[model samples]
Target: MNFLLHCCPVHHVMVLLFTTMVAMEFGQGCTQITTCVPGQPMINCSVVTHDSNSDPPIQITSYVLENIPPNSVIYCLNDSAFFDTPGTVTYAASSDFTINDAINAVLLIRSPNREADDQITGRVTAFDTPDQSEANLQVIIIDVNEFPPEFIAPDVLQHSLRFTEGERPTNSLVGRIQTSDVDIEDSESTVSFRIKGNGGDEFNVTRMTVGPISFSNLLYTYDSPLDRERIAFYQLTIVAVDSISPVMTSNPSLQVNITIDDINDNAPQFMGDHMFFIPEGLEEGVFVGNVSASDPDAGENATITYSIASSTFDREFTIDSTSGILRTSSFYKDLRFADNMRRLTVEVMAEDNGVVPLNNRSVFTVVVQRPVRFTNNIYMFELVENNNPLVTVGNVSASSPDLVSFYYHIESPGSDKFTIDRNTGKITVQESLDRETSPMEMFIIAAVYSNHSDLSSTAIVRIIVIDVNDNSP
Candidate 1:
């Protein structure tokens, strides 16, 4: 902040001057202080000391001065002047230094100049009052971080250009980001100045000489902010060498990422061989020729999605989402189909789903399916006991490419009491059959099938009955 003096310093001193003094208070051994101007009846001040027994109020009861004679006069007020239970006394700073509740003598403060400095000497006289003493207590006010730079505009990153001592004109708000640490503006601690990245005119950092600068500035403004892009990118090497033991520092720089964009303005052209003939009479779901195009734009705009140009395929075919392969979704008759011509020319196109900068289009020609067969094959199956029945058998490695469904049925000798699963082909016996009646069981066909009602397959099982009991032994 700039200031205008109301009057000259020499003239201001002539206005008026005054003097003041301190005194011990009243009440038993306790002391109080009162102020008095220069000629205003110089009330002779006196000091005294006493403990709790004396009533008046005093907590700490002892203190030591430069006890040596000619320097100070010490005395202990004989009475007992103790403070409250908390042993506290009002208007009292700390109870640590005192002589038996003794107070100090009154002190006189002198006025000053633009710069204020003063020296004082005194006798303890009484421990009751420190106001008369030379040892002093001072309070310091801290500063905050809020000052706006004296230079209205902080240096912005020079993204558009590079910096060279003589390359461009001087005073060019050279690549600099200005900021401040001195807060509590309007105070002496707050010193604002226009900031220029090159260490500013105030001082240039030849070797990081600290101490001289306000500790506030040095301790706080350690890191300088930078606009990476505008200045293109900066490789600032900051080496912090501390004087303290185990001093260490890091001289690090950074490589910023910057991507330049391209202009879209160009129309997408076609890619790959253009000509290909497909057999006539194409049907839905046919794969044919693939076509694609690309953009010169960056990011999403550069990525190309496909579609059959509407101008060409008002309603023609579909294109693969990823492969760009084109295919017919509907049947189309050959323009020459009237003369047994089964081929028709239809266009398929691709379109992009670019969120921005509009969509790009491409087209392709495809062949459709005519007539094709997809025969079914049998999967291997295994036989298993139904557990509910004496035995069960399931499909096990058997099949045929026939239209007929697998008509699984029991062909065992006890067919009336046996059945098999149509799908799993697990054959099971319904009743407990006595194999002894027919000691040698043969031709127990457990399954039958016909893929096309014309195709068939079968399997049989034979069991050898054994007698466990002997009659004549």
Candidate 2:
């Protein structure tokens, strides 16, 4: 005869019952035998779960059985479960198959010496029945490998590194990448480091092993020279990867920032050669022109100042320390030459405000020309007292060695009666002149360059008015 078992759930408790019975027997009174008999007890259980290397024992409900006669008992066939290693799985209970007055069992799973088995099986039996029934109990130990790699030393996550440009050589240690894994039992997991993102090509990482420990160091490869003027700061990502079947990288990444400090490696250079023109006799402190320079460095290394390093004339010019504007000094009035044309060569220096102070020099050529001069110092003329207005008095002339045009004007007293042509230098009487009221009219004539009023010369002229009277007595 065949017997069938069925499982039922009641209030979080699982109960297994033998539904079909084969034969029956009576013990009291007459000896009677029937086709029906007591069925064997049945046991049913769920798989118990636990972590491979964790603290605290796992607790699960004990198996419940039905179809058992009176005075029957339930117990485990063996004390431990069978797996790759013995004694890894064990169970604890109070009295009989109850724990803390409840039908719960405590399962203890020790830390595995090596890779642990996925599951372990044990046998549970119900005795004292017509025929004993056995069932299998399973315990699954899950491998705990959940932590990702992390950077510890130098703490790239909190701080950055700084280096002076051209100070360090290739293969120099930039920083050490110290890392650890909380799942220390997982000896199979190995961590490797690498560089990523911009400026990563200029650096490299190397892993080294000392004894049973391994670590990585970030190095300055110098594949491309560092220039603070070209690029001042660089940001690179440091990634730590573990050698698991499915690799795991560091979360949020380790950002390694590097700042290149500036040095006075570049010299101040003039923007271009400067040339200027200034007429003679200009007052001191006249602005000539600007002389500019620039530096590509940062901070004080780029601050530039200008100065007159050398000049053909002493104390002839001055320059601004910060603005680089060139100005004339005391020698401005004495710049004229006998040939009426003179050039001054000035050497200007542009220096940066560094500790060592790098500098550059440039030459500036300034042309100074003499003022216009009159041909005669004085001129005498006579005019009739009753001469008509707009009559020609006399002609005065001046010349410039530079061949520039001239402008003429009267500068002395009694100049209102006479007018001079600015371009032609011709003097004329604007109104009739009287010898009785003003016998002699003395005035000064001034000539200046058309473009440069500062370059000028002066001359004297005397006009005598003859008396011619027509008496109307």
Candidate 3:
């Protein structure tokens, strides 16, 4: 029985050995372990030292394709599983975007990503050829600031500053974003940010530095409000570039709008088409017209002034300033034997207070009118010294060129003014006269002699009143 027990023990040992060897073919550390980082050589280690229960834990680190070309076959001894790999492992990023295929097959970097602290995690499937896959490794690649600095939150960029003629944003922080690849924190992975948008007057990158920031330049300065009073607003673009080129993800240059504060720059000016009107029989001093203009500038620049450019009217016409009025400057006889004229051509000017001193001027024309006059006085005697008067008196005689040679009919002016004998041409006063109201006056009118036109030389006449004294002074 003791011998039987020994044989059983030997069989049990053989069974245990077989089971351990079989298990070692598939588990960690029985044969070789491949460290994912730094391309460490594959090594064979005893299975007992496998870290199945380590504390902080060791995970498969970021692995890049070794010296092999893309689509080249590689036999892998990872932990204990043998995986034959072909084709390149792709580093998938966010939705719909990825590192280029060429970058995928080798160690290449992604531009500035939208965030930091993210892992370059992706699926690495082993394929026998570029077109086929059998086993897959969910590889996790650590991330650092492989991407340059950029603005991200809000998906918007903003800046504020006092604006001048050439003013713009400078060293102020626009914003910050994350990266695509993570290297050791101390490595050159901390990419720097900069600007190319400031383009000075030509829209050069006027103000730029190697970091994320916000600021303004005094290149353009203004002591007063902007010329918005002259022109209203402006649009500008700002640019941002990076220290690391491939690490290009940055806020695109944003457009900024600036509104100019208004200040007066123009003055009121008058249009050229001005006209004048002089009332019929207008008094010499009566005002006839007014003037006006417009200003393109504001405030004090817009104020206006009025004056007589050219007034044909005399002192009789006057103008009121604020009301744009024209009144009689000095009253004058509206009635005159001679024509009264108020016609005039004149010019006026409006000026503005700008550095260049701008001004507006215009011309206007005025019209004048005249009146009629009459002559007075009449005399008479049996025989006077060749004297003629406008009216006839009691015993005196006077005649018109058509009426006198002998007589006249009351149907004509000469007959209406004097009663006359046709044969003797002796005329007498037909109506009483008042010197003040209806003073004796002479009027030369053509008179007809024969039934037809028998014209004669214009003649003279005289009329004397017997002084019945019907008129009162």
RMSD of each: 19.7, 16.5, 23.8
Please give the distance, in angstroms, between residue 410's alpha carbon in candidate 1 and its true position after superposition. 49
Q: TM-score: which candidate is best?
A: 2
TM-score of each: 0.24, 0.49, 0.34
Which ranges in model 3 have alpha carbons more than 4 Å from their true place? Answer: 1-114, 118-207, 210-230, 234-257, 261-267, 283-287, 309-317, 323-328, 332-342, 349-361, 369-473
Clashes of 1: 47
Candidate 2: clashing pairs of residues: 23-36, 23-37, 24-36, 24-37
- Model 1 lDDT per residue over 95-156, tens place: 22233334422222221111222212222221223221111221111111222223112224
lDDT of 2 at 435: 77
- lDDT of model 2 at position 107: 31
Measured on C-alpha atoms, candidate 3 has an lDDT of 0.36
- lDDT of model number 1: 0.33
Return the lDDT, model 1, position 221. Answer: 32
Per-residue lDDT of 49-99 in model 3, one digit per residue for the tens? 113354212222232222223322111223222123423333333231233
Off by over 4 Å in 2: 1-147, 153-158, 169-171, 181-198, 224-226, 243-247, 338-341, 369-473
Off by over 4 Å in 1: 1-256, 261-268, 310-316, 321-323, 333-350, 359-473
lDDT of 2 by residue, 54-128 (tens): 222222223322222322223222222223232323333322232111211323223221133444445434233
Clash number by candidate, in order:
47, 4, 63
